[model samples]
Target: MNTDYTAQEIQDLVSEVLETADENGVLPIVQLGHPVLRQRATAYNGQLPTQMLEELLEAMRQTMYDAPGVGLAAPQVGIPLQIAVLEDLYPIPESSALEREREPLEYFEIFNPSFVATSDRQAEFFEGCLSFDGFQGVVTRPADITASFEDREGKEQSRSFSGWQARIVQHETDHLFGTVYVDKVETRSLINESELWHHDDLDVATARRVLNF
Candidate 1:
């Protein structure tokens, strides 16, 4: 996919993907090796008709929920546009939730989103990507952030997020810039999905020692 697109080109691209969707309307997620995932996404600029964009967002929302992931970006679905959908409905143990400072986030879509770290504080946690299923690594990121983005109706919105929500924002926005969690992950902390359980209950210091990161 190209880094930039004309309005008509955007419409055509979305139309083609929607038309080719399976019976469940789930778009195929591009993997790590896909060229589209490495390209910076084109910013939204009324390129797609409102209705068409809505359809695309809905499809992406469905795809994200189907993958059981907290977020999904346009590039992940081979659409090189600065759009992403996010939500976290999965239940977790109270202890784990408090440890990660994680909370449930309602579903929302962001277009051309950007953010900045709000403080010097950092947090490290195991992160996974739908693009590379069954793999995870410990990534350190700012614990607080302020983000700005256009909503589905093209309204500009700005908000502050902390903890897991902030991580979700940064992770999804990074995709628009062609960055992935693995790029910032501790190499020694990379592990297979099944091994996550072994380290999941460990404290950060213990995990670091065990993983030798």
Candidate 2:
């Protein structure tokens, strides 16, 4: 978040960063240091009317698209709601290798997902969280998980995830509980936001210029 350049230049640069990221990959959002990261988000109190839920979902979608990250949590953006958004990052086999280069990002808002089961198989996945700001770490996690939660409207739902998707769901669910990715990692060997590279480029959008959305 530090830059010595002009405020006007920084503002213009922020615009480009948002634009570049949304079209290439989901933006990695502002993480834990911003105060919202530490607060345990409140679960939906059955207060949101149907329209409100829809509006909330739309805003989350746009925010996710803007931050250009594959996923985002409600608390990260200052919302205390227990809601969380996740877009699947798995690529389809039919997609070209180039297309597959960026992980598939699909949206899901799990109202209050609880882990039903965790696989015994352990695997290490390098993970990044919007709440963690600029840090990345290698974390060992269960390879599969079955979880249940409510959707945006509080309807009951359940799903099982394997591999990377399972990891993402677990990571985001942790955010709702006010947990950062660093908590899961064995070591705090930090990878600051500036140090991250998406698709081999530190500036994810600049490296992935051709992605239309």
Which candidate number maximizes TM-score?
1
The digit string of per-residue lDDT tens for model 1 on 1-213 reads: 456678888788889888877788888888999987888899888888878988998899989988889999998988899999999979988988898899899998899999999999899988899998888888899999999999988899998999999999999999999999999989888888787776556656777887788
**Cα deviation of 150, candidate 1, in Å:** 0.8
User: Per the 3 Å backbone cut-off, how many clashing residue pairs does candidate 1 have?
Assistant: 0
| Model 1's TM-score against the true structure | 0.95
Model 1 alpha-carbon drift over 4 Å, by segment: 198-203
Write down the worst ten-residue block by lDDT for model 1: 196-205
Q: How many residue pairs of model 2 clash at the backbone? A: 11
Write one digit per residue (lDDT tens) for candidate 2, span 45-78. Answer: 5645565456556666677766556677766665
Superposed by TM-score, candidate 2 places the C-alpha of residue 161 at a distance from the truth, in angstroms, of 0.4
C-alpha lDDT of residue 124 in model 1 = 92
Judging by lDDT against the true structure, name the best candidate: 1
Clashing pairs in 1: none
What CA root-mean-square deviation does each model show from the true structure? Answer: 1.4, 11.4
